[model samples]
Target: MQINVSTRHGHLSSESRARIVRKVEKLERYFERLTSIEVTVDLEHEESPTVDLRVSAEHKHDFVATGRASTLAASLDVAIGKLEQQLRKYKEKVQNRHRTSGRGAGEVPSLAEREAPDVDAEDEEI
Candidate 1:
């Protein structure tokens, strides 16, 4: 996965940048098809540090998590935690949708069945 860490008002040290990479590597265990990881730390004048994370994967679903904290590392921790929850929820939703849509579809008679009319049902209705 590609990880880009950019600080808006302040510069991040090499150690901090490495920590960010390590923080994101945990996601690999959850989602193996990650395409890119973008982390932007915005330091506004007199405002708390805000970390915005945008993680993209091959599935075309984007997982975003934003957090503001007194410290950059704190903000990053919150953002990553939120992303973990999002990824799990996203996986569950996709799995459920596929399961429901692909299964139990052929069990019921469709509208076309009534339109064409089976001989027994047609005669009974008539």
Candidate 2:
């Protein structure tokens, strides 16, 4: 998957950028169909940095999450957690939809078996 890490109103050191890339790459484990990941860090406020993550997957709209914390790393972690929860829930829903056809494998009752007991009562009266 393609990963782009961009900063706003500030810059990150090579080491810090590398760390962010590494962490973001791990998101693929949650959903293999991920096509791209975009990480936007807004450093406009020095005290509290904001991180926005946008993840795109096959046949789905982008999954977006935002996090703000005292440190950039902390903010990124929070955003990752939110994205993980979203990906997990979506994956479960997709799997469930494809896993079953809304019917069990057991044998279905015949038309006679489904009829009401009035049929048996009429026969008994005859």
Winning candidate number (TM-score): 2
- For 1-126, candidate 1 gives per-residue lDDT tens digits of 889898888888899899989998888777777899999988874257899999999968799999888888888899999999988887788778988785575787778886784689878888
Clashing pairs for model 1 are none
Local accuracy of candidate 2 as per-residue lDDT tens digits, 1-126? 899999999999999899999999999999999999999999999899999999999986689999999999999999999999999999999998886667765566768778747677788898
Which lDDT values do the candidates have, in the order given?
0.86, 0.93
Instruction: Name model 1 segments beyond 4 Å from true.
Output: 45-47, 105-126
Candidate 2 clashing pairs?
none
Error of 1 at 91 (Å): 0.9
